[model samples]
Target chain A: MDRVPILKAGDVLLVSIQTDLEDRTVMALREDLAERIVRTGARGVVIDITAVEIVDSFIGQMLAGIAAMSQLLDARTVVVGMRPAVAITLVELGLSLGGVQTALDLETGLRLLGAGPLDGGPSEAQDRR
Target chain B: MTTQPGEQTHIVELLRSRRETALDRWTELAGAELRGRLSRGELRGELDDLLSLMLRALDGPDAEAAHDELTAALSEMSRRRARQAFTPTETAFGVFALKQVVYELVTESGSNRPRLTEELMAFSHTVDELGLLTFETYAATREQVISDQAEQLLELSTPVVKLWEGIVAVPLVGTLDSARTQVVMETLLQTLVDTGSLYAVIDITGVAAVDTEVAQHLMKTIKAARLMGAECVISGIRPQIAQTMVALGIEFGDIVSKASLADALEYLLARSGVRIVREEAG
Candidate 1:
């Protein structure tokens, strides 16, 4: 019955996964994210997973899937705030998220999306968004 | 007290009364073992202090009660000698030489002739215990020294430095092992987070050889850094290492590898949008 919240800031969709996601929850999030991207026409997505620990292969695959899906929807997905231990675990598990772009934190992720071709030079991009 | 409270008390009384003779004689014997490593005058002071402690332990109303203090004093003495770089045999000889001092005193005096054999036997056991304690302490101190040097070597092998803003570099030397790999990963990750660097360069120019296991460890480190949202660039690929990697069928995949540190830095700077230009001088 519980689901992650997706908020829109300008053309980007910010999804903050603050809880440990179950398999069902992950599926729900994937579907929910796709619907929101369609409804809002969001060009960028930043999924903040700083609070999530112990990312198993299932979760890693789900994240990679989300990034791929977002790409198809014309949205750039940047997963941010991955803890060091989780990264080491993922690497040891041999599940390097090859296609996904990552940023240090949410602010950096947002800056990356905005600085690239999606948004124009500073002031004008701000006004248009 | 009149019943003679064991061997320890009898030995203590003899040592206390014959203190100067025991010290002088022990000094002479121990000096022979020292081989001029320590001056006789300096050795005499150490022998004097140790003799007094032994005498006190023997003179105690409950000699066994002084057992702990005596062991502590002996252990400290052995540690000091070890730190002074004395050999194990040299240290043991220092304690063993006192046995000769006591033996002579016990044998030369004819008053205790009736109990001479038993007294000499007990005294020999006590001196043997002291020698054993010294050898144990010497071994422990030597092990401590070796482990400390190992820790220092581990630290010296891996050094992480901040190359530029949002860029840090680790120039690795020596062979890579699991232990050193753990240090490398922890330090590199911590540095990446501390500096908030977007890029990292791991230059393995100093690494002696490249094998599959070493390659796997390097990949793990790089992947861990990427999890922290920092890209890793490996530089310093010597010809031998390159050939080894090829012959071993090691595939780095998408991970960027450079021929040298300078080239790696150039690649990093170019990606970060930093330009470098040289001006012509007159």
Candidate 2:
């Protein structure tokens, strides 16, 4: 059973989905993320899906679902690193992910999460807090 | 009994002697058919070339030997005529006229009726074969010209220009077909990558009309550009096109569209934080 890892950094939880997300994985990810958000008391979530190429309506709905669910759990969701092709596919599929926030990359995502841009390289990430 | 071999040589002999007279008569007949569409000198020169080519083709050891030469010469003549705007019928007349000349010469000769009939039949067959070759080459040449023009038009219609540092504009003219859409997509995508532009504006001012299919193609193109991380704005929405869209019940959701290229450019410039300040005349 492969599950997307959710890493906690202070109040923000980082999710980088590097694999082609299957239906079951997406469902499991949604459940696992919600539980973690409640248990760890994380306030912000950044999902990096740059490696995703083809995004059908199903994946699109799942993304929006996750965003909406995370919001209910009191965590702000910002979807980051959506590849140009995936964005095009999502638009073509007529699923705009309206409620989901987006950023160009993970750094921008973290910045939008109220941490400012990564200043001292990746190693010193979230350490000041 | 004269075999096919002996009959071929005999006809070639008769044509060789009366070649000039035959050419003069054939040229007159061809000129009449063409109705002086081309200049007299050019017409005469082309006829002269055809006469010599036909003679050379016929000069080989056997009638079958002339087949290759006749094909080569006719191919060149047909291609030239096609470029010169000669009709297929007029070009074929170039070969057909010579057949009539040979027929007249064979009739006027005091030879036996049976030999004359044999020579006339063989001459007609050879001329018919040449005529067929001419038409084939003419059709091929014309098709080549048409397709070349189409390719040139496609290339000319889609011109991607870099409007700003992070913006490019494609002004589309004429109708949008699937083939043209593919070309537009490839060019826009390539331009996006090359320039690393974050915005692209597709202006359809010159497009005469838009249908559901065209709208779909536009959607795909815009979406593809968006996927490349570039914001796409469609411009040049005429009153009639807007009416048609409403009538067709087509809605382009969330896609930014403007009334003109200027407006689209202005919107992009605003988004990119580019300010255009007019300089004072010094």
> All candidates: CA RMSD in angstroms?
4.0, 5.9
DockQ of candidate 1 against the true complex:
0.45
Best by lDDT: 1
Q: Report lDDT (Cα) of residue B135, candidate 2.
A: 90
TM-score (chain B only), all candidates: 0.90, 0.91
- The deviation in Å at residue A115 for candidate 1 is 5.8
Runs in model 1 deviating more than 4 A are A1-3, A19-28, A115-129, B1-5, B8-10, B33-37, B62-65
Q: Which docking class does model 2 fall in? A: incorrect
Query: Per-residue lDDT for B85 in model 2?
Result: 89
In terms of TM-score, the best-performing candidate is: 1
Q: How big is the positional error of residue B264 in model 1, measured in Å on the Cα after superposition? A: 0.9
State the lDDT of candidate 2 residue by residue for A1-129, as single tens digits.
799999987788989898998989999999999999999999889898978876778889999999999999999898877665576567668876767877556665676577555452444443322
Candidate 1 local distance difference test against the native: 0.83
lDDT of 2: 0.79
